[model samples]
Target: MSDTAAAEAPSPSVRSLLIMAVPAILVGVGSALVLWLLDLMSEGLQHILWTTLPQSFGATEATPWWIFTVLTVTGAAVGLVIWSVPGHAGPDSATTELVEAPLRPGVLPGLLLATVIGLAGGVSLGPENPIIAVNSALAVALLARFVKAIPLPLAMMLASSATIGALFGTPIAAALLFTGAVAAAKGGGALWDKLFLPVAAAGAGAVTMHLLGGKALSFQVTPIDQTDGWMLLWGLLVAAASALIGILLAWALPYVHRGFHALRNPLLISLAGGVVLGLLGMWGGPMTLFKGLDETTELLRHPGDYSAGQLALFAGVKVLALLVAAAAGFRGGRIFPAVFIGVALGVLAHVLFPGIPLSLAIACGCLGIVLAATRDGWIAIFLGAALVGDPVVLPMLCIIVLPVWLMVTKAPELVVHAQPESAAAKA
Candidate 1:
């Protein structure tokens, strides 16, 4: 390497890096605040819907009728908002990916409103997708107006990284997810150089979320102390089975979406979807109704309380609920509900075959299903390991994920591609 050649290379100087870091950190903090505010609003509304209102009606607890009513009405409310509100609650969630191009500022308010209602109403979806979209849109618009020095693409990256960090309670998830993406892109300088700003944003977002007392994604599970040949085999089987299940769900998504859209009226479709979800909820019970984070912890808290059949039912019902909610135009993400299904399936595996270690089963199940659903290996592996909070399960998950990845590599994704005319019609 000649001195002149090295000097001419595109290296980020400390001053430039520092200049970028300020905005990155600020974006991270802002992203976390947005997530926190949404969560707070949702929780408050949830209490009113499930507790105060129910109690006022002289229902000491959430009965089947109440569940049916709340979900059914929630569907109508969300539908009304989408139908009447400006921006129609942004793009159809079925058509968007976790990360995508920025949306117009006008679309965000309706999107956020729909998301809040879905979250509070016990819809079987997570805040990841809508929240990410909201944050990304806001960050891009704001940065473009105030900080023109940073490009739009980089702004999007910072917002996404920050949100992922806040959601998972760690910056590493964002880093791992972006590593492959950055590496694949045509760029100059070292890989770390490209990653520097995103990582800084993710770290700040993670720290801000922690400071805000966000709950951790991991749960307490029996740690895997050792590995054996049999465990590896069982891990492979569990992951493969879960992956197949996810693939099936992905294959069905578009058809289900079509069925819902056939109603040709957003309100009616949502209402019908809500009725179905209510039935599923009544059967699956409260644990299967909302995004699966807290429910996951509750399930793992006493795995012994459920038999294999019950575990299977939970997983099955939750899967149906997720499909219905997403297909019906309810606005939210699928990742959290998918995690619940995976956890339930994993626990079911253990209940049926006690020989396999619990941690491995859970990790592999989560890894497979998430991989199949998102088609993102990095996020899948991260969620799998994060769920178990066990490093020993990593090597096994790394190997198990390979075959599972192959299984879903060519599978249909859980998204819809509405025709241009149809999309405009909805708009």
Candidate 2:
């Protein structure tokens, strides 16, 4: 087409965008509701397991023995659900990403069951992966049934975006995450044109979650009001070290998974994993339990209460818990647990070196670990900034992420790829 003809061609109309927004908004709101419901259910179950039952036993709270028992039983229950329930809890979570093709509607119930059990049972995994899968499957089915105008891919994207927004309590996180994927797609529209619907969906989801009393992902930290050359150096060192730890965990994940799967029976593998996780929980205490959101807040609430050695121990135990939980076939996401690890490591850094600013250390530590774990620069940086709720750390994070990214760019990711059918069948 001639330049003049191309210039005169009409772009996607605002009316069309508005029309699509209706379903996008619905998807967003629905996604938030699903997440909220899951949280409610999980919290109730958690209270029962950790509080009611403990009180009934004449303890004010869970003892080490109690943590071990509950987690072990949780593992057995999840294993039974996966082994006997339909859809086997929707594929081994270690084999999936944050987003994928929609699962069959039949698979969602079992997946949700396993996820809730793990979440409430104090497994270290987060609700992101299973919740996203659940939302995507439902969204796709509903859209295909009632709104045929939207394509399956678009529906899936909308659902994933919405869930991510709800997960992080902000649409910006979703937009930052999807920008590269959308921009690289083989489409003909401007970038904003492509982003419009997903962003709309994300916005709706974020707003809905906020209205529903979902807490913000960010927390209070001593703000870094000033920056210096030493701060930059500290940020780089902390981030790089944190990234290395995350990368090391990723490297070990497959082997850990292989060892667990060697048990062949899902029940045995999960049961064994639960035993290990329970032991680790005993060591890490309740601070290292759950998905780490509320725990992270608690950790930051009184950093002075923990010695440097205690911080180190918490970070170490949490890492082990995350590894065991993911490898043992528990259904959940790794990001939130990873964030907790990063925060702990950052706190350790501050404790060890009082000269380093706490907020900067925490931000850099989170940035490096998240970048290594997710292999997504935007998300890594976003979480780092969000954790501190400060913009002053952004420029530092952007710079520090470069070297950490290079360190982890060629490392194995914290996911298990599916084996070939022949190998799988033999195994």
Q: Each model's TM-score, in the order given?
A: 0.96, 0.96
C-alpha RMSD of each candidate structure in angstroms:
2.6, 2.5
lDDT of 1 by residue, 1-427 (tens): 6655654578687788889999999999999999999999999999999999999887733588889988999899988888878888887788888888899999999999999999999999999999999999999999999999999989999999999999999999999989988887664567788889999999999999999998778776899777788888999999999999999998999999989988877788789888998888889888888899998998778888998888999999998999899899999998999999999989999989998889888888888889988999989999989998888898888888888888999999988875453543365
Assess candidate 2 and give its TM-score to the true structure. 0.96
CA shift of 407, model 1, Å: 0.3
**Alpha carbon lDDT at 360, candidate 2:** 91
Deviation of model 1 at 238, angstroms: 0.6
- Give per-residue lDDT, candidate 1, residue 166: 94
Cα deviation in Å at residue 24, candidate 2? 0.3
On a 0 to 100 scale, what is the lDDT of residue 390 in model 2? 79
1-427 in candidate 2: lDDT tens per residue?
A: 6656644556578899999999999999999999999999999999999999988887634489898999999999998888878777887888889998899999999999999999999999999999999999999999999999999989999999999999999999999999999877664557788789999999999999999999778887889877789899999999999999999999999999999989877788889999999999889889889999998887777878899989999899999999999999899999999999999999999999998999998998898889988999999999999998878898988888888899999999999997542233223
